[model samples]
Target: MCRWLVYAGSAIRPEELLYKVDHSLIDQSMHSKLGATTLNGDGFGMGWYDGPRPPGLFRGIGPAWGDRNLRELSEHLESPLFFAHIRASTGSPVQESNCHPFRYRDWLWMHNGEIHGFHQIKRELVLAIEPELFPHLEGSTDSELMFYLALSYGLRDDPIAGVARMVGHVERVAAAHDIRDPMQMTIATSDGEHVWVFRYSTQHQSRSLFYSRRIEALRELYPDNANFRRLSEQTRIIVSEPLGDLPGAWHEVPESACGLVDPGRDFLQDFHPEPV
Candidate 1:
């Protein structure tokens, strides 16, 4: 399992979400309160859109807190949309290529749970990826494979539909091998503007995911809170857990749900289970 966050809405430094909160993503890497593992020190990665040419990515096979390069880049880069991930490798090697927030063209993706029994279904999943996109495969983690699967299913054209189909494909294959809970995931994917996040599991239980309340609502809840004061109304975040403990600041995404966050609008709806 891993911990990750997607920040969008306001064009601000990625560090605002990666480091400013009391329990920032960097903090979670070392002291996560809700993850299966408190210390996600295997590796870390951050991706953010700047001007053009997809997004800038910085990854290291080091603890997030101890990575100076990550600190310098996060403090300097500003993007309306960004993704940060702290890894706790399940079965993959703890290398830079195995870090989260893998990218392809202008798209970026990250996941927080495992494809249950990945070792058993790895071959089938690999064979299912789009042959053209297969050449882009550069890592061995299940997370990276899942990204290619979504791309194969049409991520560039219809992310939601493509992901839904990818999960369905996984379900169909995993079931053939008698694997239960073929997936457990809280995934985020983006194309530099819109972000689609999903929280789902084959077993009806998934990792925690929460979205920040609208900035206005948060301001109302804590009128004097400096953090809320600094954020724009469009500022939104989807995380593996809340960054802070402010009341009325965060809401849990329901089990088997997908959250879509555009510039000024955000929506969360039920996610139908995918058959494997």
Candidate 2:
């Protein structure tokens, strides 16, 4: 449904992740090799944090590959954590508010899949959101709705458990409507500190997802590679696909798994379908 990239590590300009690579996220906006669509030109957005709270975000209803403003902004904005998403609107309108990398308080989120039967299931899902949070929803997107659903289920404290519970609710409700496999999601969320990513679908086959190997290991593997040399040891990235063709540099996240990049730990764990 979309193409996205998440970067967390040493402070650096966003272009290093969004545009510099041979097959960067911006490139994917025009020629995505692994997404449902090769050209995700509906819209694009970027979010970055350099403070105590969540990051600042810039979004527009323009294709990522040809946006002069995005190119200009990425060159100057630097942060230790950031997210970029190129959209291929499955149901939502291609408007600024409907762009990916939605935000709330000190948190940012983006998704690369759809809520099947969203139009039919939208009411039930919306009614489940916390009233306070519901009022804050600025867009009519299944992705943004999913974010608030996680928040209502306690995302601010325990993202993993909260998201699982939210998914559980979706499954239960969708079943009532005779909707099978109601979800396909590759989501990334962060609070300017710890970042969590999930890859799951009700049918057990989800979209593509990968995370980069540690920068140190990459440096050793390609000692003469300037790209790997410029990165910090903790530099990490999770994407809808490998950013480049560097062999052994990326690993596919298992289906029904969650990847976490905390301040000190970077690892993934199998995700069970049951409510957590």
Candidate 3:
């Protein structure tokens, strides 16, 4: 299990959400309330789009709380869309490459759950990735594998459907191996434009995921709060937990649901895996 957040809205320094919030991602790394593991100190990573080019990434094989570079970068860099993740390895190695916010071309992705019995299905899943995409696989974590799997299934064309196919493939293979509960994930992906998030599991109990309420409403409630005023009305954030204790500031994403955040509107709908 892990903790992660996706911010898709106004351009602001990452620290505003990664550190300034009461229950920020950095805080969750040391004291997560809903994750399977409380301390996600294995590693951390962030990906953000600053221009028309591909997203820039910063990853480290160290606890996010004590990483001075992460702290400095977060305070200086600003982006309209970004992702940050703190890892609590399920079984993968604690290395820089295994960090989340995996990237390819202009896309970025991260996850907060695992592929149940990953060791049993690793070979099969790896073989399923397309040959061209296989060479780009940079880490052994199931999270990165899921990213490539989605890419092979057309992530660049239709992200939601590609991920659905990826999950379907994993579930089908796990079923053949007689693994009862084969998947658990709260995943986020983006290509510098629309952001898509999915919460699902084969057992019907997925990891925690929440999206922030409309910034306009929050600003009205806290008129004097500079943080709310700094953000634009279209600002949208999805995280593993609420960033603050403010009532109605966050909404838990429903089980087996997919959330899409575009320019000025956000949409939530049922998500079901489709076999490849």
1 or 3, greater by lDDT: 3
Q: lDDT of candidate 3?
A: 0.93
Write one digit per residue (lDDT tens) for candidate 2, span 154-223.
8999998889988988888889999989999999999888899999999999999999988889988999
Clashes of each: 3, 0, 0
Best by lDDT: 3
lDDT of 3 by residue, 9-30 (tens): 8899999989998999999999
Clash count, predicted structure 1: 3
Predictions in order: lDDT:
0.89, 0.90, 0.93
Candidate 3 collision pairs = none
Error of 2 at 211 (Å): 0.3
Best by TM-score: 3
Residue 235, model 2: Cα distance from true site in angstroms? 1.1
- Using Cα atoms with residue i matched to residue i, what is each candidate's TM-score against the true structure? 0.97, 0.97, 0.98
Residue pairs with backbone atoms closer than 3 Å in model 1 (clashes): 171-275, 171-276, 172-276
